[model samples]
Target: MKVVSRIINVVLVIVVLCSLVAAIGSAITKEPMLLTVIRSNSMHPVWERGDMVIIENLKEEKTIHKEDIIFFKTEEGSLSKQGWIAHRVMSGSREEGFITKGDANKYTDQSSDGTVPIKQEWVAGKAITIGETPIVIPKIGYLSLWAEKFQSNPLLIPVIALVLAGLIAFGEIKFTKKRKKKSQGMELQLIYIVGGLTIAVIMGGTMLTSGQNLGLAYQVSDKSQGVIMGSDVGILKVGDKVSRPLSELSNNGAFPLIGTINTSDKQIELSHERVILSKGEQIKSTYTVKAEIPGKYESSIRVGLFYPFLPASLIYFLSEQSYWLALVSVSLVPGLPLMVYPFVNGKMRRKTAKLLRRKKRKIQSSLPF
Candidate 1:
């Protein structure tokens, strides 16, 4: 048993080291790809919470397998945006994009255009082994969520990273205290972990409260004065703030007008076409967007970012397997965590276990095991 434990310890250490290396390697080896922890059980038995996947765009002609883990773009917002989802490829032709279904679900994601065709180019790389073990990275989702707050304001990333690293280090402390009842202790530990996850969901939502429900960020391609895009909006002129698609423009609702915002010294600029002017007329001005929408989640949600469908399909898929329905159903929002404290507490507890034990002793001096 001692030998086995030593092996386990060695294994754990190797796992931690390798996971760290893979994470860093993934970050630096490719054009930086965001590490998305799978929150839904869809890709399950294969992917679970805490699994860290290194996503890199697949090169042209890379052969895809029937079950090779892949991520694809969906026009159906409920499924995923290019920036939004990480799921599994169920079926498809290289000539046609593969049909993708969450492992938890029964069917594939059906594109409105038709069965989605994954040309050789759209695949994100397969998830190699996680850390030193074969486990997936769902456990890391909580950490990724916490780490994101730092990304919003890069100044805080290092501080956040240090705190997270410290927490991870703390969880690694040797177990010095013996439990009076191992089963009860383990149950409490499991409950605590789940509780923490619930809190994390709440916190993720809370952070959304301050930011606009919708956010728009894109760059103007130098080649075109105008272009077709997802959101259709009228350009704001100096005095024409609320024009429909902005004065003499069609509101197709898919393409937002393209422009540049120069707020360098707070010198605002507004550019717009004349409301009634002919096609050849040029209109330009400086107009600062006042009272920006207070959340980007809705924009992403409507467009399928904070998707509830992934989780919904996952839950349903776990219970049953209605493939095509699941595919079409991937178009709605999924339930999100409403609390973040529990997850935070889990990390805190792991980090401070030794410290907590010290405090407990002062209160239990008379107790004899």
Candidate 2:
């Protein structure tokens, strides 16, 4: 019984440490780690609300076979408030993208106005599986979902921090009174404090630096005259093609990013399909829209941004072959360091402590006593 209890305690500690590492890594790297919560019954029998899904980052291995379940960012104005959706690929190709539908849903997502076919650039990751079955922890994500609400409240964080600090101080005082000896308790406390700060920073930063939804609104008029107005708002007659400069895309972040521009309609042609931008650089390209059957039509250009961890040329080439491949390759950069650092750091610390103790013993033995 004691051994079983000890094993459970060890497991819990490891889980807590891993969660802290993921939180801090995500904040520093501006990328998501491998876990996500299922918020609805869309997945139904396979995965329901309050279940935790383990995601395999597609940035390294970008192959998406038919029937593979993928996690992707939803298009602008989607019904989901979380801005992401996970669904199974029903059918499609890499060049044209894939059609996706939830297991419990009656129709494909593209049947609605808000979601289009699942594009490669929009895909973040896929569900990790074992021979056709996805791995999920049932009902464990309820706590996470409950805590998620507090993320939006700015004042709550500081209050929570103060309460935690007070509690830690009280515990330390009591422990000191009970036993007056130096131990590793201080180090563990420091780790806990740092972990809390990491969670706070990640939650706050993501809320502030969230992605912007930029789109174009055009009116396809029936008038015989073709009078092209503004870039965002334009009026075009049937069978006429007009070119207009699109909104400038700027990279203010520290890393270099590759942006792929995609349009809703087939008639829209961009001057540049893919663009690379370094820090503090910006680019503006023109898009030519060829009006077909005239009516009040709305068209949107979705730009997918990717951090170019690999060589820009390689990323470009991979994107041409498969956008999913390019995305998967670059995403490995942030997560690799986070996963490897804990073990490496622990090993180094152990070695250093052993050396210090050996040196101390040598000094004591050589002393004239």
Candidate 3:
């Protein structure tokens, strides 16, 4: 077990070192923007989906020559699902921006401003290809894609994390007993209990947060076909004490603005309106509310988790999507207890060995006599 623990620790260290190197490289050369797995066939023939390509930031390489495969961000709210894009430079200069086109595509990404030029600020990095063929680590990209899909389910990650931690804690107890030739002491048991409790509390909080359906609930008072002045119909949860910011609803010139209405104002009568929220459109509102009673309560005021709320969904999704990276991080956690156990009990172990050695010496002395 000790030998296995040592090996695992070494492997974790190597993984961490490799990650640091990649991140540092990205920061320095901006080339090989870390390890980005291709998700589309737009760069097919040269690169394909499931292929991981290295990107180098254009900042490091000063020159942006034609035919260079560069990655850049799209215009804000362009609606392109691909957050960042990589394409070959077809025309234009680096001073202003460069015109880019995907090798597999027939038409350029031109807009009203002629060929849409990717500004210097948008250029992420250039792909480091060998002889027109970008280095491809095939099949591994599928793992990343799968992780991303699984991460979308909010509950999956937190549950899995807690389970993994529980398993590690159980394994550690057994291993420690085996090594020490006895059960762990009260101090060590207490430490394990505290750790377990901490994990439990955190997981419980995350679960509660995910299930909380807090949103805007509003109604028209005058009925003059005016915009909903206060809260829009949505899901919201009221928490005891403190306040949090909820979604912001814009009139957008579509609805007539009657006036500003709020529950806190005490002048407006807030009513609950059942609204089937538009999926994927979680609104960010400036309004905040404090619920004296915690539960699903409908009110005109938007309620949010109290200030300093953890972004449970975002955290869980990222952890699940970056499964490989998360595993590497978790591997380190298990190794810590294993390594520390030996150090913490080293004196006792050494004393036991010394006492056994002395007993053997005494028996040998008696036999000679």
Candidate 4:
């Protein structure tokens, strides 16, 4: 019984440490190093909704080949809204671009105006697999999906932390009763655990509340003058331009953040490409859409939230290059300090204490009292 309990405790501690590492790594790299929940049945037999899969970022594995399952961003003019999709590579090459298809779909994503050939720059990451089989944790992702719905709530992280702390305290009470002499060590362990949890909560909360996709659906026709029916959807004629306010962007987290607005389409223009917000701040901005061609169009605006520790010039340059890179750089502001603290502070304190003890012993011996 005691051995089984020990094993369980070890497993729980390892899980907590790994969770902290993953949260910090994703923040610093701007690439997800944790499990992503499957949201659809497109992969069906391989893995379906509610299953979780791990991915390796494209930066780590630049060479993609046929039959590899990759996660990529959907093109602006594609049938589906601009978002991420995970599919298997069917054919094509780096120069020509690759063809992708869902495992259960009859046609390629490029077929019938679904999407253009998959560009190299569009790929985000590839699903991790072992010998043609993906590592899947079944049904566990439902918890994550459920948690996502409450991400906007400011109290969510605090509520969760409180619950976890209560559980830990209860366990400690039982353990201390059986081993009173080890109470001090257990208290130290509890402090470390709580501190790690706090960091993880802050990182997770910031990432979750930072960004969202805002889209505009409109039509261009030669017969009528341009008119915006609502904030997002509208009608326009060739050479016409219409502007409207986008949904308000809010910073619900406890810290200040930099929000950058970006678009893949040339016809769309934002009044403010970047805005900085303090805690609980909200801002509304407008975007103009130009009609160059006669057709229905959908434009997606990507808002990425980043920590504001980097220089404004550097942040602007990096944001222009890639939002992910800017995010990665900003994340290091907090992550690097946390990572270096233990090694620097703990070692220095230990060495200082040792020197002080040695000097005291020499002084006592010389006095011969």
Candidate 5:
């Protein structure tokens, strides 16, 4: 399993969960507190996407310390594109405010908004770790598509879920009971689940083929050079504008497309699966519409393993049920564990420290420093 993906999913679920907490918290308190989602990778490894946050507004004097995950409101970036960023406070104090930097970045972004000591009031709250968003829950965009298909016949989906759950649960229970009766007991049960999971992994892996699978017949988004198709990387034209499906486009190939860069096409100069059509080529005419490959319910799940959090989070956000309550509840659910995780982790750390100290003292008594 991809540890990063699991962490990201956990972040998304915690976000939904935290929103509920924030809602409740917001309702009960008479403060200017608010909650928002993590916008960037400023404070990563600790806080990933969909990580729910609690911003406790301290109006009078917002004090800060060395490493505080902060939500600093500022007029940074293009008004339209980069609205705000919530990064961790790298270093600073209440007097000099604080200098902040993203956990992942090499250097600090120390502007007034990026670096200055945030007034205690500007801060929201400390960040926390919740459980991961479930992988199964978010793929509902496809479900939503199917839901629309069965709109008039709505009961179709729920009935199916209930039925499937019931059947699987029943079979597993019966099989488990029978297995437990055997001499091998837990060993046999463990073996059965592991074997089943292994089969599933193989099946899922086989099913995933990737962009290369998009053949001549399958209509795919022709976001490439007008003349060439995918796997046919081309050069970038000065006047010909291009964009990629992904953020980072790797053009370290022989046929890098340098299409005419013009209006309507704006993206990273180099990114993959984006487009390389020249200025003249229309999005449609440039790329043949053989068979459009619809993006996954989530961002294309990382083919290999980085962490599927992005796609999973996307899937959760696009769940079939449009109810506000359901949406908020599910979003916060995964994050609830995150907030709890910090505390749990802190406790564990304290315990570990204490044990180390005791061991150290015993050693010192036996020997010397």
Candidate 6:
């Protein structure tokens, strides 16, 4: 039982460490081509929905060739609206951009017109395929796809975290009891350790939930005059501000627009009101969004939660320094006393034993010596 518990604990620790590493690595890379799960069957028979695929960004446009499978930024107003697409390179050259087509599709993405080709700048990455076979890990992406459906509901995260904490604490209690039946005093100490760890986990999970619910960051691509992306659950309360780098445009035609601010649960204000952004080369602005209601709401262009959903949340939680620091603080507050009590109690016991021995010696010496 002890060995098994130790192993389980070790595995959990390793998972947490790996999550932190992955999150940091992804941030440093600046590209989203780390690991993404397929949500569509556009590249069917080869890679299906719920299949996990690793993406590596193509460094140079010259390396791209016909027949290679590549992932690129999706055009606006597409059915999926996922911002990215993966397809086979049907035809093109470096100078004349590329026209990609899904293997299962009848025509190209542009549907045979071929007038508007995917620019070299738009290509994100090329799928690493072995010969004609695309290497894929099957059925693992279901978690991601399922999470996307509930991605709007941020509250689910804390609820899940609380449940996990309770379950873990219960398991630890049982395991400690079964392992240390003789050491009754150590039971409470073990609980302290277990409870502290559990609380830390819950805190980390809650941090992730809050970030997903409240905070967002996005970059305006050079190709796009304007773009909006976000979840419906994301609410910007009245007086809340969204700050981002604004692109400078010669004309007022391409100014930033925030649309569809919900007034009530049913009614919405279609806001096409243009706000003047700071001028010069690097135009940056923080638009203090107006909300009809004083509570949580969603914007038209909400941020998206990334792939491998739950794991992403965990990783994201660990990525921040504040969460880790808070975890340490919270864990140590209860854990320190529990850990020190055992040693402190041992010293007290030894002192008491020593005093008893001295008392015995004094009594003997006084009696008949």
Best by TM-score: 4
> 305, model 6: CA deviation in Å?
13
**lDDT per model vs. reference:** 0.40, 0.63, 0.49, 0.68, 0.38, 0.49
Candidate 4, residues 129-159, lDDT tens digits: the string is 9999988767656655555544465445545
- For 1-369, candidate 2 gives per-residue lDDT tens digits of 969998997876655444444443443333445766677899889999977778887773487889899887765436445566889999987678889888999999888777667778778888999999999867666655655544333334445555655565576567656653344423433444454554444333323222222455566767765444544446667878778886576666555667766665777888877787777787886788788766655566544456554676776676666544655555444334333343357753564466669778999999998
Q: What is the lDDT of residue 184 in candidate 1?
A: 31
Which candidate do you rate higher for TM-score, 5 or 6? 6
Question: What digit string (tens of lDDT, one per residue) describes model 5 on residues 277-355?
Answer: 2223323212212123322111111211111212433433332222232233333332333223323555544644666
Task: Give the clashing residue pairs of candidate 6, or none.
Answer: 229-301, 229-302, 230-301, 230-302, 230-303, 231-302, 234-298, 235-297
What is candidate 2's TM-score against the reference? 0.49
Candidate 3 runs further than 4 Å off = 1-32, 76-81, 111-115, 162-369
TM-scores for all predictions: 0.36, 0.49, 0.43, 0.54, 0.27, 0.48
- Please write out the lDDT profile of model 6 over residues 186-212, one tens digit for every residue: 345555455555444433332232222
Query: Tens digits of per-residue lDDT for model 3 on 227-293?
Result: 3444442223332222345434222221121111234433223332112223232334344343333
Best by lDDT: 4
Those runs of model 6 whose alpha carbons end farther than 4 Å from true positions after fitting are 1-31, 75-80, 112-115, 149-151, 180-369
Please give the lDDT score for candidate 5. Answer: 0.38
Residue 129 of model 4, lDDT score: 91
Alpha-carbon deviation at 224 in model 5, angstroms: 65
Give the clash count for model 1: 67
TM-score of 3: 0.43
